[model samples]
Target: MLNSCKLQSRNGSKPIVKQASFLTHANILLRCHRQAASRLGRCACIRAKLEQAEVATQKTKDEVVVERVSSTGGSRKAFAKAFTAILGLKLAKPEDLDPETLLNPPFPRYQVPGSDLAVQKLRPYFFNRTYTDTDVGYLAFFAAMHLVAVIGGPLTFSWEALEVCLAGYVLTGMLGISVSYHRQLSHKSFRCVKPLEYFLAYCGALAFEGDPVEWSKMHRWHHMHSDTTADRHSPRDGVWHSHMGWLFDESLNSTRRDANGNMKDSLSPPWFYKESPEFYSWLRATYMYHQIGQAAFFFALGGVPYLVWGFVIRVLLTMHMTWLVNSAVHIWGEQRYVSNDNSRNNWIVGLLVFGDGGFGVKLRIICQCRQHIPRHHNNHHAFEYSAAHGLEWWEIDMSYYFIRGLELLGLAWDVRRPSPSQLVAKRIPPSPSAGASR
Candidate 1:
């Protein structure tokens, strides 16, 4: 009964283990080098600003030496080049579209040369798409589920069923989506026991976004290509696409389209849940039976009421709340950290996704309401391993609290957080802080 949405997981660094694999160690070193390069880039930016200021006081021509990031691994270069061509852009690789170009304009915005057109040049928003069988299946499933949840749920609602729904929401949303999918799988923010990890992953699978592996791969891809033309769900792709349209295009390998809707390059590809033979083997083994078993358990507990509220209603709400992270958070919220992508720390979303849980008691008192729990999602995009999202104590993250609790209980360990220096490096300087804040 498991849908055919394929899944894949790249071999990631194990931040917890003392004697990690050589590849893991190498990845860590690479991350450190990248961070160092970013710091150096920031310094270069400051020097440029200072030179600009000095030009007013005394005219001098001393060019600052800005470092250009080296191209990625060699053998991969040919592969990347081909991939880039398929995506339709002339870029050699993905790194070519990095945020550093925001200052230097590595890939400059296209300019129409004196074309008497009202809109001179088009923004690089990818719109060319095709609705595949997968798309139709997803839409049909989603629509059917929503219909049942809407009409059947209210008709069968009872206080007992409401209690079950509330519990199911917390289980599927918090444990499944937030903790398992987001923190553990997607970001690798914390490491937990394998059994617990698998259990949480199973809970997440019930959310039906996809198997945990696929969900994590998609999310990781989002981070890697955030806000770029390659980013599958960036609002820049069009708000609707970011929210749901992108779901149909599970084949991440498709090339992007030109402004005229011509396909440029072919993206890479997707994986079936079995692609990850290790981490997600159990999920694949029991994908269908496990889900059916849960539904049966709910039905046995409270018949039609429990089945309607626990399964249908919970799935519908979870789907929307998850979608809002892609659409609403990006559009409505404010950015705390100066990340490259347009990711924001939506307080409203933070509250809904991860409840206040007594952590933001002061914010609650001041705001005169229960909401306003700070989830530094921007920081998540900035420092993937950071368990702590909020910069200060006031900005509470219940998700982090749970992770910390698990760590204390010995259920999890080696919770990764960004160092003070790492934070300072990414910090927006007061001079250009206002611009970065936007």
Candidate 2:
């Protein structure tokens, strides 16, 4: 019977139809299997590439660590040798020690041989003693301002003057220095319409910090080489040096300028400058005039009292508070992240400068009442590009809030922030005990 059925299938019967259907199904399965294998192969290749990239990234991180350790070890050795030579116990040559290491000793000691003070006071140790004309002008200008603020402030007093001082503090300090100069210009954390951006830059000019271009360049340099020898305002270079002494250091200006007196391309100008060079250049040239005009206006409005409080006192306060960010915040406060620098989340500096506070009932109440946002300085160092420096809810960032307000109003866009995953990746892992307790 089987032989008869096979013969019938060969002659095109129902058995033939069934046999053809089974063959077609087998061909389909084979094709499907081949497609699946191809997809698996592609997935495996992608996975391999990802693993390679991860390995490379990890290697780079390890290399950075090794380099840092090697640099630190070399600095320490140089310091030890220098100290021994200073004591006359060893005859180590000055040239043998790293020049930077000599200038910036690992530990604090009196009479550091190559320090700025030593260069100034000690015989035959000058590195950059010849101050530029620009340097002299800056010193004289700042001195005059300080003298006026100190002498005139107490002499002229009025309630209206105090109110004016407070208003200018908020306008120039918070809006100008923090928001416009630091976040917008230096970091480009967010973008606003040109008119608003220029207006903010004008306000920042009133703060008497450098023009937007110069200020942003210095700030960028600080971030790029933070706490290293290149940092313009690192606390490692002495508290006063970081606070205000750098302003008089003309060598820094020389380094950033080319033979033609143009800012080096490497230290590129900020977006605002690139967008409108003439405008910022004009501001740079006439920024002092703006301050003078402001003083005159205040004098006209309420005589000596307004001039003292609104211009002199306000400028002094703003200057010191902003300088403290470069000094106090780096020297004090809690380190929330490993940013490879001495940046800290200082409550006092934060409260005064950016309105950031810490974990306390009083602080929380004040933050809520005033809606004052705080700058988490450590977070900022860790993620320099992040628009919002306050990573945690308690780390209220007023500058970020102002940017957020602009964003909502369609005046700001392209606001940048680290993703949740990126934040997690950058965060330091908790210790075993802490993790267990949590």
Candidate 3:
């Protein structure tokens, strides 16, 4: 009986030991599998990061190539060898240049206007007719002024009338539009004492572009979305659309809404307007009255001649010249910098509008206030914050000179400009030999 009991105990112990060994082997296998999975996950994460970095690098390389093509101009082969040597990118077949591609994509918040809009059709003889009551009034006023200028200008051709027209052109076109509305108000390139600032703004108002706040807002928007479909006055749309057709488009009266039905704050009122809302509001409300008052004063001062020459012809000339800045400059002109938009350094437009000294004109004449003006519209686009548009010494900018004069008088400060390093950084890289020489 004792031998039988011993045998049973031994058998049970053998099975128990085998079960314990099997459990140990299963745990070891599970741990190894988990570790292998962990390593694979780590490798995948690393690969993803590397791919992202490569994509970013490739995108940067593409942009550099595009900028090279834009800045250098001419056949792609002209810069292809230099570009490849510099960037180590394989040169592919050159693609045809598309101006639209050169421009930046529209702001994420911007909604493109539909093609079916009446403004796009642009009917002749002002017959498209989408004007609100206020727009109609504006159209009528502008029409009347234009008629008087065209009809009465030659009829009342006197040296005195011509002198008055030229004087008004200098005061309102140069001081008001270029110095005040453009450089000072729109760009905030320089600071002035409040009195001087207000005086400059009032001078701009006399040009009859719009109130200071509204004009600056529109200009800022232009810079923000230049050459894109969102641009308010891009020549890509049409020369006439950029020039004077935009003025009649009533859709430009207010800020555009986004997909969510919220007004886009991208074109919010300028800092000056936010700082002094009441003043700008009053200025906007009383803008038309100021023009009317000026007309009355001109009539009272020198009768019909003063009205035609000082107010009528002056406004007409200023309007067309300013419009040409939006039209001719973009269409013609040379591109000195690789800006996203198609802004050009149109010397002829600059001569007429900004009083830029024309070809072969002496610098002395520029300083004497004979042809004092702004030039280098592309430079303005390239360096938006710069108070000085004329980067080169010979490229005279009277607007910048005005700002400098104000600074000398202690009336302007905090004037902004591109440093030498910044200018070099933005410039297109020269050929390898030229770069080595530098």
Candidate 4:
């Protein structure tokens, strides 16, 4: 039953599903070109000369990595083309998809638009805006531990003991998931060697969000559509929808294949998703198992407080905080490059999530326009795989610093930064100078 769908090649050469896998490789290579072309890291500062050139001018070998983002950009345009051709497929078309649609599905036929508009008015309230399940799961676990504490009365009293939870959560969640795993490993914002890369992925799993495959897949989708109706979790839709609500609801999740039945394996973690689902399963299960198993061991060896603060509360806080970036950063910060969507630069967010995981730093090089070209993360939403964020020097970004450290340690190589001329094209003229300054 290979019914050709909207995602399928209209001419039917091959399923676009096949094209999804190389998204990462394609993105990285394109980023390299953008950086090399810009010369952002060269010797200069602020408003570098913009070098506008066809990304194709680079050698084929170099350009081969960045693929043709659906000419439709995971939007309703892409969705419509698929929907009309496929009869029953419920792909939302561009016109059909608006920021308000999620909160009030006009098509569900709000018959009594006047009579209280029950569904539409109520829809926004319908979502769980407060601490989500993952949030609840986190807090509940900690509360349960507290109750257990009062019930069992463990004999341990020391504030220093509590510090382990702080250190561990900060180290792993910040360095591991946000920085190493999601940002560097999955996105390739900067380079890293196998050892560091593997460690990053490992700690990411320890965060217990899911597995690497799942995390990266969802992240790629976010970049693919960004603000459009198809965007998995866009704040533009609403704060509740963007936060963690998407994780619980299937509708907000990404569909792996296009109308063509092509799978998005390439966007998945290296080797784990592509070479062997079996290995990924093993990694996923093992990470889950030891996370629980180790806690029990710690309880037996160290005591219940170790388990309560170190495991339960720490996990609960860590996850929600990590997710806050998705829910908060994009919606709160100031937009330096005017790409689309609500993405912005929140300094507290960067501090909270390890320099906003390097995007800002990479952008700084791209936006300089003299020594560095602007990356314009707004441009990134337009084109996700490109590695620059288009931030300026006055703006501070930490993720890039850590990546640089990896390079210094020889744990990472092929570290790309923009050149001078390339920065120019990505630059925006200094306004009242209303952005973050490090």
Which prediction has the highest lDDT against the true structure?
A: 2
Give the 10-residue window scoring lowest on summed lDDT in candidate 1: 61-70
lDDT of 2 by residue, 1-438 (tens): 898888877676776789999999999999999999999999999999999999878865543332210122223223334444454553312222334644554544443233322211111122425543334555666788789888888788778889999999989998998888888888988999988988998999898775676678778877777766566566666666777877665455334333344332345446676578677766766665677789899889999899889988898899999888887677766666678877776767777776432221234465444322334777788888878877766666777889999999999999998888877877766568655653
**Better-scoring candidate (lDDT), 3 or 4:** 3
Let me know the TM-score candidate 2 reaches against the reference structure: 0.65
- Look at candidate 1 and tell me the lDDT of residue 95: 22
Alpha-carbon local distance difference test for all models: 0.62, 0.69, 0.68, 0.52
Clashing pairs in 3: 354-373
Model 4 misplaced stretches (Cα beyond 4 Å): 1-158, 251-272, 275-281, 357-396, 432-438
Model 1 ranges off by over 4 Å: 1-130, 249-253, 256-279, 355-375, 429-438
Worst 10 residues of 3 by lDDT: 67-76
Q: Please give, for residues 311-414, the per-residue lDDT of candidate 3 as tens digits.
A: 98999898898888787777665565667877776777777766321112446664753332335887788888888887766776777888899999899999
- Alpha-carbon error at 58 in model 3, in Å? 44
Error of 2 at 398 (Å): 1.5
What is the descending lDDT order? 2, 3, 1, 4
What residue runs in model 2 are displaced by over 4 Å at the alpha carbon? 1-131, 252-265, 355-375, 430-438
**lDDT comparing candidate 3 with the true structure:** 0.68
Estimate the overall C-alpha local distance difference test score of candidate 2.
0.69
- TM-score, cand. 1: 0.61
1-438 in candidate 1: lDDT tens per residue? 123222212222234254466678899999999999999999999999998888744522211111011122322223334444554654212222233432243233332232211111112223443333434445556677888888998799899888888888888888899888887777777888878887888889887665665567677667767776656666655566667766555343244433454321221212322234465654544555556677888889889889889888877788888888886666655555677877776677767777311123446667664433455667667777676666556777777888899999999997998888888888655447545643
Q: What is residue 63's positional error in candidate 3, in angstroms?
A: 36
Best by TM-score: 2
